[model samples]
Target: MDTKGIEQMLSVLRSTATQASGNVQESGPANAGGVDFAQVLQNSIDKVNQTQKQADQMAEKLAAGDTSQNLHEVMIALQTASVSFQEMVQVRNKLVTAYQDVMNMQV
Candidate 1:
């Protein structure tokens, strides 16, 4: 339930949206901000995986009759994981489309 992870995911989604719309700047080095695109992508995927794993664990605990686990919290965690996963899928689709567009272009 770390807010920072959520923020990072949102930022990744936003960056993907910007790239899909061809709004990315080309005035300087791509990694001028000292951020490695591959690392960011890996981190995002890891975050999504972690979120899903956590949700699964929470659901299992609830089903196992753990009285300390609240039903509402588990439901919320499941929903969050679902939404994050969907967002990641959309980002992947956009990246694939962008790559295709680049590859099909005549040099």
Candidate 2:
């Protein structure tokens, strides 16, 4: 991947993190229209799913000898999808660990 693509991805991650934190802070007892944690998680998963789908389509097109598709772009997309999936898995593992720890805590 090029520096520009990496920078763009970092910017997107930063914005998403900021938005998630902002939503958490704003979702107090008085905020009736606050975002739900489940919804946020679902949205993130959906985005990752979409990225993976796009990558898959690009790979398929390339394999079918599509002249319009660039090899570098297809590779980048595949890598991005793979990294996103790994990150999501890590997040899920952390969440599960946290939940288990909370459950095991003595009240």
Give the candidate number with the greatest TM-score: 1
What TM-score would every model get versus the actual structure? 0.73, 0.71
**Alpha-carbon runs more than 4 Å astray in model 2:** 1-33
Could you tell me the TM-score of candidate 2? 0.71
For each candidate in turn, give its C-alpha RMSD to the true structure in angstroms: 4.6, 7.4
Q: What lDDT does model 1 reach? A: 0.78
Tens-digit lDDT track of model 1 for 49-93: 999999999999999999989999999999999998998898788
Ten-residue stretch with the least lDDT total in model 1: 1-10
**lDDT for each residue of candidate 2 in 1-103, tens digit (9 for 90 to 100):** 2233334434544544565445544545775654456666676778789999999999999999999999999999999999988877876786677567657
- Candidate 2, residue 84: lDDT: 85
* lDDT for residue 101 in candidate 2, whole number 0-100: 62
